[model samples]
Target: MKKRNKFKHFLYLILALAMLVYALPLISFKEGWSWASAFGVAWSLFAFLVIGAHLHYLLGVDEEKQKTLERIRAAKLREWQLKWPEDTQRRQENM
Candidate 1:
């Protein structure tokens, strides 16, 4: 991951957290605060924001791995290009 992408992801997470914090009081206080409502909010934030974001990040890692593998395979092919074949009349002479 590049520095810029990390910064952007961090900024997005911060913004989301700030928004949730700002809304917590309003949601809980509006209906006079209950344990269930608070729990629901917490669960929703974790499931949707944290888990979802991390899942997306994990998926991106696989994509990056694939690109790296492709590059490595290409390099290996280039390295072996010189020794690819030596097809000549030797096989016909033996037969």
Candidate 2:
């Protein structure tokens, strides 16, 4: 899963770069404006938006997993408290 995420990140980076390159013609123009230049710029803008949204989604998923782990840990700690109240109190005092 880590490898897959890394691969996906790199893939998005490469695609964004490629779109940036394609859109470069829109800025550095020796000739007059053309439909292709406009299209390239539009395409690159869309790619930027898509990549931003995808990264945001990935961040949200990670945060959700962290929240889930915290809840699980809290539940286990409560169970341990119920099962061994004195020992748990002693350990907390030691910590």
Superposed by TM-score, candidate 2 places the C-alpha of residue 36 at a distance from the truth, in angstroms, of 1.7
Q: Score candidate 1 by lDDT.
A: 0.67
Model 1 error, position 56 (Å)? 6.8
Best candidate, TM-score-wise? 2
lDDT of each: 0.67, 0.75
Task: List residue ranges in candidate 2 displaced over 4 A.
Answer: 22-32, 57-95
Please list all clashing residue pairs in model 1, or write none if there are none: none
Q: How do the residues 1-95 of candidate 1 rate in per-residue lDDT, one tens digit apiece? A: 56687677667766666766666665554676599777867765774676458456644776788899999999998867754543335555677
lDDT for residue 60 in candidate 2, whole number 0-100: 64
How would you encode candidate 2's per-residue C-alpha lDDT over 3-93 as one tens digit per residue?
6986787688677767677767556445666776667667777888877866775566677888999999999989887889788788999
Best by lDDT: 2
